[model samples]
Target: MKITLDRVNENFHFKLKNERGHIVDVDSRAEFGGSDLGASPMELVLMGVAGCSAIDMISILKKQRQEITSFRAEVEGERVQVGEAKPFKDIHIVFYLEGPINEDKAVRAAQLSFEKYCSVSKTLEPTATIHYKVVLNNKSL
Candidate 1:
């Protein structure tokens, strides 16, 4: 996989394109002299983790014959400032699942995604403590 980033101006505004020709705009916030055109690089990392695990959980649940009505994930991260390197200290994903899906199965699907299937989660596991919670039918489990 290849990605190229080019500066759109003299500042941090940039256009990123992948090998598949997929493109996204990336820039810093207004305080950083950027126009806030798109997501920051650090923010993108969190998005990747969320997207990857969400896909994994859905796939696993579907295979298990789960009758999911609606699914949503709320992901958040905390970045620690240490020296010149700032990295995520922790990441949390809360899954809101609705339908006839059981709490146990929903939890297991999330576990399987974070622990076994999600590449993004595995990649960040060494640097970040990944935590997850499951809520089924408007009830937190």
Candidate 2:
């Protein structure tokens, strides 16, 4: 896929456009002259991972005939440096599943999704240590 980034100002503010023509604004604290309404590139990458895994887990659970009342994914990451060459050293995803879900099945689904299905997880595997946990109805799965 292709994406375009246009400068919004002399600072780090920019507008990003994807192949589908969707546009998003991105700016840094130094560029935006503030701390609100913008996501750093690193934050966006973590979001991508969360989104990818959430989608896959939900789909897998649904196909398995699990009654899901609620689902949430919490993603956290650690940065190793401050330059363009810097990378996220580690990432963690906590999948919370509610409503009559099987713990073993949920955990297996998450593991399979990260290991073989989620594109973002697969792509980041080479760069960072990706860890995950599954919680079903407030209990560790």
Predicted model with the maximum TM-score: 1
Expressed as tens digits, the lDDT of each residue in 1-141 for candidate 1 is: 789988898878899999998989999999978899999999999899989988998898899899999989898999999899899999988989999986788999998998899999899988899988999998999
Clashes of each: 0, 0
User: Tens digits of per-residue lDDT for model 2 on 1-141?
Assistant: 899999876677788999998988777775437443478887889999999988888899899999999999898998787575779889988988899988888998898898889998889888799999998999986
Candidate 2 — what's its lDDT? 0.86
Candidate 2 residue pairs in clash (backbone atoms < 3 Å): none
| Model 2 bad stretches (over 4 Å) | 31-36, 82-84
**lDDT, candidate 2, at 84:** 56
